[model samples]
Target chain A: MSLDKADVVKIAHLARIAIDEEMIPEYTNNLSGILELVEQMNAVDTDAVAPMAHPLDMVQRLREDQVSEENQRDKFQEISPKVENGLFLVPQVIE
Target chain B: MEWETVIGLEIHAQLATKSKIFSGASTAYGAEPNTQACAVDLGLPGVLPVLNKEAVAMAVKFGVAIDAEIGKRSVFARKNYFYPDLPKGYQISQFELPIVGLGHLDIELEDGSTKTVGVTRAHLEEDAGKSLHGEFQGMTGIDLNRAGTPLLEIVSEPDMRSAKEAVAYMRKIHSIVTYLGICDGNMQEGSFRCDANVSIRPKGQEEYGTRAELKNINSFRFVEKAINIEVERQIDVLESGGKVVQETRLYDADKDETRSMRSKEEANDYRYFPDPDLLPVEIEDGFIEAARAALPELPDQKKQRYIADFGLPSYDAGVLTADRETALFFEQVVEKSGADAKLCANWVQGELSAALNKDGLEIAQSPVNAEMMSGMMQRMADNTISGKIAKQVFQAMWAGEGDADAVIEAKGLKQITDSGAIETIIDDILANNAAQVEQYRGGNEKVFGFFVGQVMKASQGKANPQQVNELLKSKLQA
Candidate 1:
């Protein structure tokens, strides 16, 4: 589960974070430490216990399927970096 | 060695809910960009997701229809990835525990043989916004109107052996969802779409080969073509002493080939963990029972009923029940016209379908309705018009000429059942064609057809064929 410098660099690239070459070693150490702690947790023998996903034993709240919102495109698009023809524009992205 | 193609599909059916899955924003299509995106859909600070009961009910309905295990408690997980279309860095979806468990769907292949495809699971997820790449000036445009729309991603086992079987499996799912009234099943609008995982191995290989996923194929035809092309590519690669690389490929339908989009190493990790904002969904027996009770007759059941009750062929039943609107139209025609089932089936499949195809219209968009069609059928039944003249009358009705009665009256297309008028026409025809009559009486029975043609010509094609045959036989015999 230990992450090396190359693994750290790959992770950073996937996350779209521009990290310096010198910072990769430091990230590798920190990420490997976190993974070691997770491995330690995973070492426990609690096979009979049911897996838990939520802290509180509560079910999700349900809402009626009705449209209550009105059009606010002009106001929302005002905060975007770029917009044209009622579309939020970005640097071109190919599939 | 013969190669075998194995395929499994992941279908995303957009649920027909009034609003987004976790927000109050409208989920209606073709809205102005970002207008329908509410605070929750936009991932504003400190926003939490609440499940839509209608969407949950719909998922339950599908589970019950397919006879799947409806999970009493299902956890929602956050699949973390980065993309421009995803306003939130993570999409809320189910991973380990889905709402629907292992199920099966029975699909009828082209050879009229049925096969059961195993359903791995169906999970709920929120859709990302659409990224329009080419429309703008070298810039990508994002439409958030589709953001947070609810989708049921149905995963299937690797049970398909060919492209045709895969298409059949997809079509069965399409019919089922539309029949349940849960999804609109509009592939063009992208309410229904699929990603296909394709692989190929030797004829008797126990283990599957490295698979490639064909992403976001929107139509059934494209699904078949994409899978066929991918299978051919994989076989070719293996035969050339190369291995098929695990990757995501895009089907360029215009080019009729699959090109690599991203390889396994470049693929996103999609680190998945349970969502903290939303709690696990728990269902009660009462809810499941109510959903089951509310379920309509599914496509397979309706197809069986059409075959059993109406005596329709298996193929006709399949075609008629492929869509809900067409089935309802057929039922209405039967109820109104009280016509024979086979005749009704033939007319709907033959004349009506042909006309609809010619005009590029769906049954729902037909200018002539069930009532109008039933009236025409009645005219044909009562010896009022021949089937040939009925088609002409239908064309007239389609041109907005009026109903059956009006069209028949305006065109004087009614059958000539009047015995006295037919007798006069026959006598005039006989007097004019003395040579043909003599030939007929001189043991030349083949000349009877000419006499009948002459009589029909004199009657302007209004003579009832059966009556004309009987009357001409007696006259020629005497």
Candidate 2:
């Protein structure tokens, strides 16, 4: 359940976070501590208990299926870093 | 050593609702980029998602149509991932408990046999926006119009042993969804699409081999080809003493090959947890009853009814009921023309289908509709036109000439049922073709066809064939 320095680096890369070499030990210890907590939680015997997806027992609110929104492309794209031809532009993504 | 191919399909069928699943933004296709994306769909901070009632009803309809167990309560979860198209950094989907569970679809195979494919589950989810790559130089354009659209992701068990079975299963789902009017079932527009998980193992092996998922294949043909190619690739890798690597592959239809898109090492964790903003969906007995009552006659029931009532062969019934429009058109033709059920089936599946295919039109888009077909069949039944001439009339009708009677009259293509007119044509043929007549008299029974052909040709192909034979026989004997 413990994360080492290499594991921290890989996790950071997957999360797209930039971390300095000095911060790897700190991240490893913090992540491993969380994992150890999860391990301790998993050790409890609860064979008869039903798994719950949410803590609240409330039901979902249903909405009417109608087109109630107006076109706000110009206004929404105004906050983007880049936009062209009514599209939000981002740096090139390689397939 | 034989290899057994295993396949499972995950189909995404977009619900035919007016608005997005979580927002009131328009779900209409081909809207201006980002126009239909409201604040909720754009994933603004503090915005909550409200489930659309119509979308839930459509999902329930599918579950009922497939005879699946409807989950009384299902929870929505956030599938965390990072992509340019995913503005929210996650997708709202059902994880552990889907709405529909443990159903089986009975598919009629090409060999006139039926096989049941197991459906693991069908869950409701929101689609991501499209990233328009390669169009903008050094940048990608994102269109969020498709984001938040409702999709029912139907997952199947790995019960398919061949590509054909997979295709049949996919097509059966397509027909059911379209028949229910829940999905438009347009694969080219991506309203309906599938991802195939394929693997191969030694024959009779209990354990499954590593599976490679082929993603986002739109057409049934592509689904079949992609699975076959992937199966072959897996078999090759296994035979070469190399273990198959589990990965996600993309089917390049143009090149007819599947290449690795991403391997397991690079795959996303997709940490899924229940969304706190949206509550668990609770399906009451009233809603389930309403959905059941609203279910139309599905394809299987329609096929069985066609077989039982119309006395059609299983194959004919299957073909007619494969599509709702075709089955309705067949029924209308039979009801209007009062033709025999077998005859109606033949004309619809044989002649009408051929004509539709020739023009690249669906039955709904047919220039010669069911009424026109009934008229043509009625003409044939009443001896107004022979079977041969009816085809000509059909062509004329399709060419926008007129109805069956009008075409037959305008072209003088009516059958000449008068015995006297046929006798005259036969006598004229007998006189002109003396050598063939003598050959017939010399006990050459096969030469009779030549006389029939000549008489019909002299009569401008209007000579009633039976009458031509009868009259020509009496005269030659005399």
Query: In model 2, which runs have C-alpha deviations exceeding 4 angstroms?
Result: B263-265
Question: Candidate 2: what lDDT?
Answer: 0.90
- lDDT score at residue B270, model 1, on the 0-100 scale: 87
Predicted candidate 1 versus true structure: per-residue lDDT over B1-478, tens digit per residue: 7998999999999999999999989999987788898878888788888899999999999898888999999999999887778888889999999999999999988789999999999999999999988887778998888989999999999999999999999999999999999999989899999999999989998999899999979999999999998988898899999999988899999999999887434756888999999999999999999999989999999999999999999999998998898899898888888888778888888888999999988888998899998999889889899887888888898888999999999989999999888888888888888898999899999998898888778877889888888888888778
lDDT by residue (tens digit), candidate 2, A31-67: 9999999999899998989877778767788998998
A1-95 per-residue lDDT for model 1 (tens digits): 99988788778877779999888888888999999999999999879989998999888989999988888888877888999888889888773
Q: Is the docking of candidate 1 incorrect, acceptable, medium or high quality?
A: high
Q: Stretches of candidate 1 above 4 Å error? A: B263-265, B435-447
lDDT of 2 by residue, B1-478 (tens): 7999999999999999999999999999998899999999999888889999999999999998988999999989999877888889899999998999888889888888889999999999999999999889899999999999999999999999999999999999999999999998888899999999999989999999999989979999999999998988888888889998878889999999999887434756887898888888999989999999989999999999999998999999988988888989999999999988898899889878999998888889888999999999998888888888888888898888989989988888889998877877777888898898788788897888888888888887788877888888887777
Q: Per-candidate TM vs. native?
A: 0.96, 0.96
- Model 2, residue pairs in steric clash: none
